[model samples]
Target chain A: MKRKPSIVVVASSGGHLTQAMCATSLVKRDLVLVSNKNMLDGSHFTRVYTIRDTQYNVLIHAVNFFVALKILLKERPRAMFSTGGPICLPFALAAKITRTRFVFLDTMSRVTELSNSGKIIKKYGLYDSFLCQWEAVANDSGAEYHGQAFDLGDHGHQ
Target chain B: MVKPLILVTMGTNDYPFTRLYNAIKNDSLYTDNRCEWFIQTGSCEAPVAPACGVIEKIIPRADMEDLIRRSALVISHCGIGTLNLMLKYRKRVIFVPRVAAHDEFSDDHQLQIAREIKNQRMKVVFPDDQFPLLDYEQIKEDNKLSDPVDITNYDLAEIINQKLTG
Candidate 1:
């Protein structure tokens, strides 16, 4: 049987990881999930990799950049999909350099504006396509206004 | 089950949300009403008193999900992750936000999210707001449990499906 195209699903821990999982659960093909250590329960994915959490440290961030690059090189996935976060940036960049298509899904928290991560992706044209959960964010950031990642279980919690 | 499990989580945010932790710890109702308490304290130091099951570090996703599934009520810091999980499980939630003034969070975004949760099925509890914790008799008298709100099934999933497939 022919191998299905795999998309790399990447994010930071907590909300970013959760949003990525919820959104990527929709993908029909295989998925390669990556995030910071213990940030996700990856039993659902065929492959899962954990990167260390280094949000503010410049040196560690640089090291993890290569770590992300390594993962992308190994996976060579068809597409890289991410919910915006610091950790996902490296993978997105590696994917960009490799000419792998990248999709950036802005998390639902930034209702009125684009998050810091989202802005960086939009400003640099890092993603092949950028999607926003809220229409206002899409309007302000010029990312395409896709529906929210949280709507499947939004439960009016906002 | 000796008592309904009331799970309290401050999320896995590195900063300890002492406000939520203290609120539940000091409140007499959770114990007085015989609600067995389990708290995922994360980085927050668990209370020495009130003797509850505590998780001080990040837990695996499945373990977290199982706790949520078993809980009768969930009291949480207004994290999108915790809220999303509660919504997915359709559990009754008491949403509490870490406040900037209290130095609980770097920003007041959680407060904004908590306000929105007020319009939903969950009850929003602000730091200074006077809410009687676990007034079981009053809840039963008011018959509040019968109406189940379907807060899931918004258009986000469809949009993602379309974006990926089409």
Candidate 2:
């Protein structure tokens, strides 16, 4: 029996988690959810990895990097789909080092420009595919337009 | 004893969006006391101002959903969580962005979100703007609650499935 390839879904809690789950809700393969504690409801994730909520703190970020690294090594996901915040940075880097495909979806909130996370992902050349919710900004950034990237109705249930 | 429920949330973000509460406290609505206000303040300390009604540091998800369902009006920071809740229920919402200069968020992402929402013709109030009651009243009169863009069919799961398989 072969193990199914895993996809690690990463985002900050709250809206980011909701949006990320909207995208991940359609996945038929193995999936792992990562974020700060108490951010998600129910048991949608195969496994949950909780990292410290690093609020622009350098030390906390370093801690998160190691935590992400450990999870990535253990899960060995083939791809990472992230609707991001500070957490995406560590996962993006880990995905890169592990040769995992990285996907960064610019939050729908950003209309004119890529979000700070999107900017950083681009700066480091981490994302295998950079997608935007808005076509105008997608054209501006030469990224693919993915229709609308966020949906409120998606409660992560298939 | 029954007052219209007005839900105020700064979302689950750790930063304190005190400005929204301050503006709401000073707004004419705060003095009325007739309206029952339920505030989900997140990481912000309990407000010193007595004007802010029923403050919950954090409400459980079930209770939050219930509150959103029952509330007549929602005043929220420009977080996607609250935005989705408002839009999902088609609840009338007043969006206030948290500013970085005020030490609320590390960046102006919420401000950007607010501007984009305003561009979409939703009512959004900035911090530097005059007292928000006038606009709030105008929105109440207009009673315009436009459904957000239809994007529910765009499935993230399907996208990932295709990428991994194809």
lDDT leader: 2
What are the clash counts of all predictions, listed in order?
0, 4
Worst 10-residue lDDT window, candidate 2 chain B? B139-148
lDDT of 2 by residue, B27-77 (tens): 677666556678888987755544536888887666787787776677888
lDDT of 1 at A28: 77
Error of 2 at A107 (Å): 1.7
- Which residue ranges in model 1 land beyond 4 Å of their true spot? A39-42, A152-158, B30-33, B118-120, B138-166
True lDDT of residue A117, candidate 2 = 80
Classified by CAPRI criteria, candidate 2 counts as acceptable
Error of 2 at B66 (Å): 2.1
lDDT of each: 0.71, 0.73
For every model in order, the fraction of real contacts preserved is 0.35, 0.35
Q: What tens-digit string does per-residue lDDT give for candidate 1 at B24-121?
A: 87777544545556788877886554544544456777777877877777788888788778777767778888877987766676776666563455
Q: TM-score of model 1, chain A? A: 0.88
